[model samples]
Target: MITYQLSKPVEHGGHTYQNLSFRAPETGDLIAAEQFKGQISQTVAMLAMMSDVPLPAFKRVPLRELYQIMELTKDFLGNALATTGD
Candidate 1:
């Protein structure tokens, strides 16, 4: 597992939430997420799946916020990959 402090938080239904904790995704995770195929919603969905937080909470996140969240996920995963050599 790897944790990162989110520079930005995601809000949904008047609730604010963030996950600084995530699991290193497996190759299967990549294959599972591939159906999203460059779509932001699916990318966010993948990040939510990787996070320690409950995935349903992110379902309501605004589309505008997904890019930033995706960037954070990318950075976290990249750093995780570098450190773990997985």
Candidate 2:
């Protein structure tokens, strides 16, 4: 698991989030993310799945933070992919 503190808290769906914790993505998460039409939408869905957060909640994140989250997700997934090739 990976945990990241938010630069600022975000309120969504009656909950306030101070941080995001993500588990490694599963096969279902990957398939679900692919359903999105664009790379941005796919990445957002993937992040939501990995973090176990609802899609709408990500919209509340600051853009700068969101980019960081995207990089985090990408790096973790990339590392996973690299290992699986062995």
Candidate 3:
């Protein structure tokens, strides 16, 4: 799991979260996130699924932090693709 410390914490459902830990996304996560139409939305959905976090909670994340989170997700996908070709 990759744990990311949020620069700005997120509050949701009466609780605050300081960090998000993402497990490597499985094929099910990719299928699930496909309900979202755009690439960005899909990526965010995948992140939520991998982190076991509710999607609504992502609304409170700071913009800068969101970009970093996207980058992390991209890195995971990139690494997975790189290995699968071999």
Per-model clash counts, in order, read 0, 0, 0
lDDT of each: 0.57, 0.77, 0.78
- Residue pairs in clash, model 2: none
- TM-score for each predicted model, relative to the true structure: 0.49, 0.82, 0.82
| Evaluation by TM-score, superior candidate among 1 and 2 | 2
> Could you tell me the lDDT of residue 71 within candidate 2?
78
**What tens-digit string does per-residue lDDT give for candidate 1 at 1-86?**
65555446766656667644667666665555555545554465567778745456766555555555566568545543332211
How big is the positional error of residue 66 in model 3, measured in Å on the Cα after superposition? 1.3
lDDT of 3 by residue, 3-74 (tens): 899987888998788999999899898778777777667777878888888899976678788888878777
Arranged by lDDT, best first = 3, 2, 1
Poorest 10 consecutive residues of model 1 by lDDT? Answer: 77-86
Report the C-alpha displacement of residue 76, candidate 1, in angstroms: 4.5
* TM-score for predicted model 2 compared with the true structure: 0.82
User: Can you list the residue pairs that collide in candidate 3?
Assistant: none
Clashing pairs in model 1?
Answer: none
Off by over 4 Å in 2: 79-86
